[model samples]
Target chain A: MRTLTVELGERSYPIYIGQGLLQNIASFFEKHQITKKSPLFIITDTHVAPHYLNDVETNLHKAGYTVISAVVESGEQSKSLAVYEQMMTKAIEAGLDRSSTVIALGGGVVGDLAGFVAATYMRGVRFVQIPTTILAHDSSVGGKVAVNHPLAKNMIGVFHQPVMVLYDTSTLQTLPIREVRAGLAEMVKHGLIWDEAFARWCDQHAEDLLALDPETLAYGLEKGCSIKAQIVSRDERENDLRAILNLGHTLGHAIEATAGYGEFLHGEAISIGMAGAALLAVQLGADPSLYTETKRILERFGLPTVMPKHLDTDQVMNAMMHDKKFKEGNMVYIVPKAIGQVYIDTNMKVSAVRNMVERLKEGDIHV
Target chain B: MRTLTVELGERSYPIYIGQGLLQNIASFFEKHQITKKSPLFIITDTHVAPHYLNDVETNLHKAGYTVISAVVESGEQSKSLAVYEQMMTKAIEAGLDRSSTVIALGGGVVGDLAGFVAATYMRGVRFVQIPTTILAHDSSVGGKVAVNHPLAKNMIGVFHQPVMVLYDTSTLQTLPIREVRAGLAEMVKHGLIWDEAFARWCDQHAEDLLALDPETLAYGLEKGCSIKAQIVSRDERENDLRAILNLGHTLGHAIEATAGYGEFLHGEAISIGMAGAALLAVQLGADPSLYTETKRILERFGLPTVMPKHLDTDQVMNAMMHDKKFKEGNMVYIVPKAIGQVYIDTNMKVSAVRNMVERLKEGDIHV
Candidate 1:
């Protein structure tokens, strides 16, 4: 297994990535001097529990740990206050304590919701991320866990890092094609912000990745995690460099909100959002040629490149206004200056963004 | 105004403690370089709203801030998932953004719930504490915000620090006598863990404090905040030294849980819990004389020296088992090593705790 450390001083932890990492989770517990009997609370979504919960439970039990699991519903809706309540109740009923460790098993939704639970439950507790989806490659590493409010996505959450992340790529074999595409969007995002070579590599091996070729998938995951690790280490709280990671996320989050959560997968929204961002970059005189190339590569991966027909431009603008990147009523868009560089622009006018939204609605962009 | 820094590195913020701190809140905003038109969400509980809501609103309006207020019901029950949902909705409707600031304007419950709202809103946002109750002197300054679940007190929350704390002591003038006594329990605890002089001062002037004398009250508030601030600076996440702040809270939280929240104020239960810890300390051979003196002093302040008669020992024990401090199936007790020092004992047997409960029932210790 290869280990990547997310350094945040004392709050730092390692992300272990490789095949069959789940088999040796007990070793991780042992290394941390945490035992199987250390009051383990496993949080998984309904989608994941049916597939991997028993294996995890069996392994934990064999390692001499008492295990209790809380399974939330599967989907974006699961990341709500209602589910957070259910999970906390289940955890309390199962007797989780300060020394107890929570293992979040599933995709981004499960990881984010469960991580928030661990961050708040009993003030805080040790948490482990056993990500079962490709999207979690980003969510699991960053320690930014949160649930969504009905009014906003991820409106309620915390930046509580996991003690360890057991990213067993073997688990991804079970993911649906759509999920794989979602994960690829983030991998592309990593390259767009920091590494041109990795982005080119993804473009070359997109087919290999789609086919679930182990080597190609592993390479992508590792490179994406490494780039994220470096950025998080310098700006753990997203004060500067970290905001670049939100390349497609600003408009992407707005799309997700306007289209209604679960209508478009997070990565799908981001794929289209990236297109919008790239187009906006060109509008601001940042080389429209590079934007076209980026859009072509994203579409080749089967990622969406257009806005959903039903979403209102005005509503989308309102949603963007609520984005965390907005400063003093001004929307701060993280637009790319080039393929391997981006900048946060607080001076961007809403009129420009609205115009772009109108163009998106008119099918000015290609998928 | 007296300014004290929480010293939590990047998360560090200033606590402005004095009469009329609320009137000049715009200056604090200016110091942080926050704008007057910044979207600010003011969170308060029913009990505190009628007293200070209009004034706080007027101040924010006069300072040109686009302010909105969300008022939850008073009491521990208000710290539930339902209330959090309502608050978030209100915040979203009022256009609270990532750069927007949430001002928690009430006692501990409001501070915890509002702080948590800010922590999770849009992944996180800036929050300021405008604590009106004396009990909040401890809760507001330390960034230890949480909302209690039905099964556990503060079982759901986060350690989200505020950007600023506006502690207007004048608001405490109208506080009920019971609340004054309750808030003193924490002041006494601060002294027990760090400063013996402060403890002795509380003991000697317990009556003056109970009467809400401005000088004594202000001294206790400042001392408590300073001690907590020092500990928080060294251990913001409560990994080590900060655990000392929870000296009486291990059992204190259990009492609040078993006694059915809101039946006894947090401090009142903590007062009883401190007596339990003192008894345990004596039994463990950690200077029995100190236990007698501590109990006498607590009684002089009109704090409870025993658990309420209606509470069952077994029920309390069961609740204690669910405490977050429990490690490896063993509960870690913070027993006093002396009047001004304490040690965490993980080896303490459950049987010993049970025996102490029996002793209390038989009137073996003064109530």
Candidate 2:
């Protein structure tokens, strides 16, 4: 097992990356002093519940922890306020209290939803993130937890850190190939924004990383979480440095929302977004070679390199305007200056972004 | 204007108490440097929108703020997650962003729902509390904002303090008499938990305060807020001292939920809850005089001295058992020790609580 700690003052917690760690959750609970005296609410989705819920319940039960499970539908729609309220009701019916802890036992949707429930339930409670997707390597580390609104993505939420994150790489074995391909985009993002050497390492090992090789996948996840933890620790509320973590997310979120949620997996949209960001970065005087490298690596992972044809450029622009990153009607782009380096460009004109989208549509953004 | 700061480190904010402060909101904005470049979303309910929303919008517009209004129906039902989601949609449609601010312009329900929206919007934004109800004197200051869950009250929410609470005493003059009577219970609670003298003052001036005597009402509200702010500063997450603020709220919330939200104004249910707590406190070896004084003061304020006949004792107990305060199958009661002192009793048996509830229903308890 490899351990990395996200240092967020008193809110800091550890991320444990390994294979088959789910079987050993009993010891983790004991070490953390989460006792059976206080109940445990295991929040999962239908997709994950059938496969791994019993495994977790068995382990926790063996550790003398009384556990209750709250399962929602397995998709982005489960992150709505209606589902959030329902989950709270179930947790209460399960007799959860301030002392009781919540464990999120699925992919990013479950983590985001359950994490949010823990964040607001009783004004915050302790929760653990057992992220089952590579995408969650990014979501699980930072304390940012939210649910989407029908009009916008992640519009209602708060920053609540988890007590710990137990990443069992073995869970990757059951993911569909398409999901694996999508989730890897966030790992690529971690590299593009902060670590040139790690970006190179990811490119070289892309095949092995995608194959779910335990050691390689675990190493990549640990590195991704480490970068995320460092960034979050410094800029917990995204005043400055934290915004860099949002490198591809600005355009990515807009594309995802425009394509309609679930039309493009978050990472798939982000992969395309990173390409657009690269184009924007090139306009900001970045070395054109960086754009080439980012696109090449993303394509090698089978992620989208351009915006979907069905999505309207004008609609994408409108969605971008609603992004939390927009300030004073100006869209702030996190453009890459080089591999592993990005800068915020708030002075960019809307005409220019529209032109970039037009170029993307025409397959003309290539340097 | 009298200003009291809820010192929560970087999250600290001021509470301004005076008459007609709403008219001088432009100056307050200028002093606080809440620039007009950022948009403002004034969230008000139908009841308050008709009375004061225009005044606030006009003041903000005069200060150069580009203002937008999102109005919901007035009452407790508007505090549902459904309403919360709808409010987020409206705020987004209004083009609110990181620089934008939300102003809650109504009673406790509006303050709570709007405050929660501010707390979670874009992971939080600046919001000022323009409380227009006497009950808001308590809700506005502590920043305990939330909506209701069908299963429980305040089941889905968080603690996000406001940037400022601007209490315009003049707004109280427009409140219906029943509401004014109901709201005073929180002030009485503030006095009971931390300030014996304030309790006496509230009892002596009950008539004048109920009559909207600005001097008496403002004085009581300010003192109540000072005590609450101090308690909140010391324990932001309710580890210990902050739980004392839940005085009368355990049974109170259960009673409220049991009767159905909007059936009893919060203060009315809390009045009955305080009576129950007083009885429990006496059984726990408190001075019997504490119960006598509690009943007398509640009577002076016209607050309910017994549970509503329609509410079932069994249902209220079941609701209390699910309270966030319960731990390991034990309900922790914040029983009053005296006029200004209270202690947490986690070992209290349900039979004892049931006995107290029966006494409350039968109107047989006496000092």
lDDT (10s digit) by residue, model 2, range B177-282? 8899888899989999998888888989999998888888888889999999999999987887888988889899999888888888888988999999998878
Docking class of predicted structure 2: medium
Error (Å) of candidate 2 at residue A154 is: 1.0
lDDT of each: 0.84, 0.87
Give the proportion of true interface contacts each model preserves, from 0 to 1.
0.86, 0.77
Which predicted model would earn the best DockQ?
2
Task: Give model 2's TM-score versus the native structure.
Answer: 0.97
> Which ten contiguous residues of candidate 1 chain B have the minimum total lDDT?
B358-367
DockQ of 2: 0.77
Against the true structure, what is each candidate's TM-score?
Answer: 0.94, 0.97
In model 2, what are the clashing residue pairs, if there are any? none
Off by over 4 Å in 2: A363-366, B364-367
lDDT of 1 by residue, B214-246 (tens): 777877888889998998999887777787777
